[model samples]
Target: MREALIVWGGWPGHEPEQCAAIVAGMLRDEGFQVHLDNSTRAFASPQLSTMSLVVPIFTMSKIEKDEVSNLSKAVREGTGLAGFHGGMGDAFRDAVEYQFMCGGQWVAHPGNIIDYRVTVTRPDDPVMQGIGDFDYHSEQYYMHVDPSNEVLATTTFSGEHAPWIKGVVMPVVWKRRHGQGRVFYSSLGHVAKEFDVPQMRTILRRGMVWAARE
Candidate 1:
C-alpha cells in the first residue's frame, strides 16, 4: 500500500484538523496507509522520506529551518507533496523555499466568501478528467503562481468585489514538479464542508492520487 502523511495545524479558522480528517479518509479509501499528525514536527519523521505523498494542512504557521529542509529534501527525492487552499498555499509565508516547492502562494482572497465559477482549463489532464466548470461559493483566491505550473482550472474576477482585479484570470488548480516529486494544489476548500461539493471533492481526490509517487 502507498504511504501518506497528513500534518495539520496552524489556523483554527481554516479548520485544519477537520479538513485533514476529510482528506485522510479519502486517502485511506484509496488504499493509502495514512498517518495523521497534528504538528509540523511530523515533517521531520524518518518515515516521511518513505512516504508516497505528504499533505500539509498547516496555514499561516511558522516552520523551523531544519523541518522545512527535511520536507523539501524528501519531496526533491520523489516523495510527492499535495495540498490545498491557504493550508498549503499560504503556509510558512516567510519560507520562500517552501513556497518555491509548492509552485504558488496565496496572496489574497477578494470578496472573502463569494459566489464564483471555476473553469476547467485542461479537461484532458487526468487530474481534471471528468470534471467540469462548476459554481463555487467561497474565497476567490488570487495567488502568485509560478509560470511553469501546469494550470488545470482557472477563475476570472468579476470586479464586483475587487475593481482592479476585474477580469483577471487566476489559476484555481495546478500541478507541477519539485525535483523528482509531483506537486499538486487547488485554491479551494476553505473548510472541510466545501469538499461536499462533488467537483471539489473529485478534483482533490484525483489530484492527490496523481501527485503520489510510484
Candidate 2:
C-alpha cells in the first residue's frame, strides 16, 4: 500500500489536529496507509523517502535544519507534498528552502474571515474536475506565490480591505513540481470546518491523490 505521513502542530488557532484528522480520514478512504503525528521529527525518518505523500499541517512554527533537509530531499526524490491553508502556506516562515519547496507563502489575509468567491481557472484539470466556482466565507488569502505554479483557481480582491491591491487576482489553488515530486496547495481552509464545504473538500481530496507518487 502507498504510505502517507501527516505531521501536524503549530498555532492552536488553526486547529491543526482537527484538520489533519479530516484529511487523514479522507486519505485512508483513498487507500493510503496513513500515519499521523504532531511533530516534525517524522520528516527525518528513514521511511520518509519510501512514503508516497507528506502533508505538513504546521502553521507559523519553526522547523530544524535537518528536518527541512530530510523533507526537501524526499520530495525532490519523488515523495509528494500537499497541504492547505496556513498549515502549509504559513509554516516555517524563516525557512526559505521549505518555502521554495511549497512554492508559496502566506503573506496576508485581507479582511480576516470574510466572504469571497473562488473562481475555477482550470475546469478541465483532473484535480478540479466537476468543480465550479464557489462562494466561501473565510480568510481570503493574499499570498506571495511562485510564478511557476500551475494555478487552477483564483480569487479577485474587492479592495474592501486592502486598497492598493484592489484588483489583485490571487491564486486560491495551485499545483507545481518540485524536482520530481508533485506539489499541490490551496489557501481555502482556515479551520477544519471550512472543509465542510463540498467543493473545498472535494478539491483537496483530489489534489492530495494527484500529488502522490504513482
Candidate 3:
C-alpha cells in the first residue's frame, strides 16, 4: 500500500498534532497507509525511500539532526512535503538546512488575526480548479517569501497594519520542487476555526494529494 510518514507535535498553540490527525484521516480515506508520530526527535524506522510522502506539523523549534537530514533527503529525492502556515514555515528557524528545504521562513504577520482575502495566482492548477478567489476572517499573514517558489495564490497588504508595508504581496498558497520531490505550502491557517471553512479544507485536501508526488 502507498504510505506516508506523518510527523507532528510541538506548540499546541499551532495545534500541529491535532491538525495532522485531521489530515491523516483524509489520506486514510483515500486508502493510503499512514505512520503517525508526535515526537520532538528523529524518526525511529525512517527509511525515507519507502514513503510516498512526509507531512510535518512541527512549528517554531529545532528538530533532531537525523530527522532533518532524512526529511531533506526524502523531499530532495522525491517524497512530497505539505503543510499549512507556521507548522512548517515557522519550524526550525535557525536551521538553514531546514529553511533551505522549506523554501521560506516566517518573519512577521503584522495585522494580527483578522479577516483577509486570497486570490488564486495559478487558477489553472488542478488543486485550484473549482476554488476561486475567496475571503476569510482570520490572521492575514505577511511573510518574506522565496522568489524561486511557484506562488499559487497571494494576498495584498492593506495599509491597516503597517502603512509602510504597502504594495507588498504575500503568497497565501504555493508549491515548489525540491530536487525530484514536490512541496506545497499555504498560509491560510492560524486557528482551529480556519480548518472549518469549506474553502480552506478543500484547498488543503487537494493540496495534499498534489504534494503526494503520485
Candidate 4:
C-alpha cells in the first residue's frame, strides 16, 4: 500500500490540527496508509523517503536545518509533497530553500475573510478536470509565486480590497516539481470549516492524489 506522512502543527489560527485530521481522513478513504504527526520533527525521520507522499500542514514555524535538509532531500529523491493555504504556503518563512520547493509564499490576504471567485485556468489538466470557476468566501491570498508553476486556478483582485493590485490575476492553485518529486499547493482553506465547500475540498483531494508518487 502507498504510505503518506502528514505532519501538522504551527500557528493554531490556521487550525492545522483540524485540517490535518480532515486530510488524513481523505487519504485513508483513498486507500493510502496514513501517518499523522503533530510535530515538524517528523520530517527528520530516516523513513521519510519510504513514504509515497508528504503532506505538511505546518504554518509559520521554525524548522530545524537538519529536519529541513532531510525533508527536502526526500522530496528531491521522489517522495511527493502537497498542501493547502498557510499550512504549506506560509510554512518555514526563514527557510528560503523550502519556499523554493513549495513554489510560492503567502505574503498577504487582503480584506481578510471575504468573498471571491476562483477561475479555472487549465480545466483540461487532470487536477482541474470537471471543476468550474466557483465563488469562494475566505482570505484571498496574494502570493509571491514561482513563474514556473503550472497554474491551474486563479483569482482576480478588485481594487476594493487592495487598490494597487486591483486588476491583478493571482494564482490560487498550482502544481510544480522539486527534483523528482511532484509538488502541489493551493492558497485556499484559511480554516477547516472552509473544507465544507465542495470546490475547495475536491480540488485539495485531487491535488494530493496527483502529487503522490505513482
Candidate 4 lDDT tens digits, 1-214: 9999999999999999899999999999999999999888899999999999999999999999999999999999999999999999999999998999999999999899899999999999988899999999999999999999999999999979789999899999999999999999999899999999988899999999999997
Q: How do all the candidates rank in terms of TM-score, highest first?
A: 2, 4, 1, 3
TM-score of every candidate = 0.98, 0.99, 0.94, 0.98
Model 1: residue 146 alpha-carbon error in angstroms: 0.3
- Estimate every model's Cα lDDT from 0 to 1: 0.94, 0.95, 0.80, 0.94
lDDT of 3 by residue, 71-187 (tens): 888788888888888888788777777778777878888778777788988889988887899988877777667788988888888878889878788888888888888888887
**lDDT at position 130, candidate 2:** 87
Candidate 1 achieves a global lDDT of 0.94
Instruction: After the best TM-score superposition of candidate 2, give how far the Cα of residue 96 lies from its true spot, in angstroms.
Output: 0.4
Q: In angstroms, how far off is 185's CA in candidate 4?
A: 0.5
Q: How close is candidate 4 to the true structure, as a TM-score?
A: 0.98
- Encode model 2's per-residue lDDT on 96-209: one tens digit a residue: 999999999999998899999999999999999889898999999999999999999999999999999999999999999999999999998999988889998999999999
Which of the predicted structures, 2 or 3, would earn the higher TM-score when compared with the native? Answer: 2
Off by over 4 Å in 4: none
By summed lDDT, the worst window of 10 consecutive residues in model 4 runs over: 158-167
How many collisions per candidate? 0, 0, 1, 0
For model 2, the stretches where C-alpha displacement exceeds 4 angstroms are none
Q: For model 3, what is the error of residue 170's alpha carbon versus the real structure, in angstroms, after optimal superposition?
A: 0.8
